[model samples]
Target: MRMQLETCLAQAGGRSDPRTGSLSTPIHQTATFSHPRLGESTGYDYSRTTNPTRSALEKALAEIDGGARACAFASGMAALDAVVRLVIESKRRRVVCTEDPYGGTIRLLEQFFRPVGVVPVYVDTSDTRAVLRELDAGDVAALVAEIPTNPLMRVADVATLADAAHAAGATMVLDNTFLTPYLFKPLQHGVDIAVYSATKYLSGHNDVVAGAAVCRSEEMGTRLAAIQNAGGGIPGPMDSWLLLRGLKTLAIRMDRQQENAQAIAAFLAGHPRVARVYYPGLAGDPGHERLRRQARGFGGMLSIEVDDPDLVPRALAAVKVFAFAESLGGVESLITFPTVQTHAAMDAAIKDRLGINNRLLRLSIGIENVADLIADLDDALR
Candidate 1:
């Protein structure tokens, strides 16, 4: 019988070891495994190529995302690098991407992919007409979309985008980091590839930094696997084990996180110091209805713009509970000044155009008490 998602997550690495009846998946920490003889071998040879712990983690990820296979990487960027390489190998030199994506993604495309002749085209993916117009130009190899895009929380119509991409002979790659498989499954929405920054929600504690790519088809899975092995960016066995452990509690963490986020978004939306709130959970948000139709939940990320730019630093310093930090998707609530932190690498022109300005603040809500979290923000805004 096929288990439900919550059950699958709760039992992520359980019952894998029949030998000693170990409930936890054992971490196989070694550079290489020994073969019994010249003609025979264990499934794992080099740790770099394969490790028992990583393989188990990968299997769990594939099952969670409903993919043919999943590949683990050292960092989220490394997984994206492998995916880009796969696109390059296919000889489709151009990639259409979501506008206002994570700054690191823009940096990678400009600094790395551009020099190597892979063109990156950025558009507002929420605007399906704009995406279709771009696709009409044609040499596109892949369309990399961030579901409810970074900081802004703008939701895209994934199934519609995927259909357009396929008609244009392109692969649809979705960054499902904001909403993990617990909230949304990209494959079910017609996405060809589902990418994740496992360090965030998947490894909810923020301890392990890892990345994953889940391919919809076995053919794409084989190709991505080749890129992952050749690129040599696989995470260590320990990190993989930690991520697997993290996966076990994904459902509970996400539920509480989103619940807190909804209350906070509502609070911010009505605040005197607040200028705008960008969270799909809010009924007034532009993407709220679309996200409601496409995803299981609105996720725990929200961005707010204060009436005064000076309020940015003051709030960052005054916040009691929310940490003033860089990365997101953890158990602790974080307040980030995108202009200087996560999106600092982004171009000033694009920043202005997208409202990623000095007054803008991104929040990663945690599983904290709703009243306390709201009170903290209210105090900080003052």
Candidate 2:
């Protein structure tokens, strides 16, 4: 019999022995593992290299992504850096990216990697022809995409882009932080590398800051491991253990969150004060058809274009339920203006091209009651 996702979440890496049978994985907080003899160490010589708790988390992650191996890092950027370091052979190279990626990713590419000669070319991935045209140029070392992209909810066909990247001899990397593995698995669709900001959906509580990378092959896994060891951004045992505990309830939390998002999107679509609603779950939305074919379900994020930019502050203040904040994928709903908050670092010209306007509000629907969430939005809009 095949194991269900919820079952995997509850018991994937669990060990229930009498000597160490604890319902929750214990945090192995020691700095080093003991070696009984002069030359024999028990897999972990030092905390920087490995720990039992961290190992357990990595094993769980690899299993979830259907990959050969996984690595945990101190932050999402660190995980991305580890992967990029594997391909940057010179300072004058380029990476192809989607037009609307997470703002921090764009900033990292422009500020850090650009100085080292790795330029990023942003294109509208929704247009397969445009993606093919850019890839055919042969300058791109890798292709990076964020399905259901941050704040915009744009869905990219992972298998199609992965085929293009592989045929061109470039790696296809995806940021799977938004959808999480519960709703979508990139490796099954041909992605060579999948990365995540575990701080978001994986952690599910907004308390821990961690990242992960899953490599399709053992050779790529070894390369990433070397970069992780040399770069030294591995997550501590406690954070890894916390993330592992959070993974146990990922399915339940996401199920409720998606239900709430669907309701909120419908409400916003019919509201007179809203100009437009962007959600992959909406039947006629731009990416709806492609999304239905790829993802198991529409995610818990949506964006609404307000009639007036000035109404944002009033609406935020009036809302008694939704919290006005940054970061997302928590148990509580969050609302923010992407132009001023998440995408502030993006250039004005690029922002205009991507349609991240001043009146666009990004809502991270949480695992709250659907009726309560809609009522709160209604009060705020009024």
TM-scores, all candidates, are 0.99, 0.97
Scored by lDDT, model 1 comes in at 0.92
Clashing pairs in model 1, backbone N/Cα/C closer than 3 A: none
Q: Summarize candidate 1's per-residue lDDT along 212-297 as a digit string, tens digits.
A: 99999999999999888888999999999999999999999999999999989898989999999999999989999999998899
Candidate that scores best on TM-score: 1
Q: Compared with the true structure, what per-residue lDDT tens digits does model 2 show for residues 314-374?
A: 9988988899988888889999889888898799888887789878899999998889999
In candidate 1, residue 114 scores what lDDT?
Answer: 93
Off by over 4 Å in 2: 16-18, 89-92
Give the number of the best model, judged by lDDT: 1
Note the clash tally of each candidate.
Answer: 0, 1
- Measured on C-alpha atoms, candidate 2 has an lDDT of 0.88
lDDT of each: 0.92, 0.88
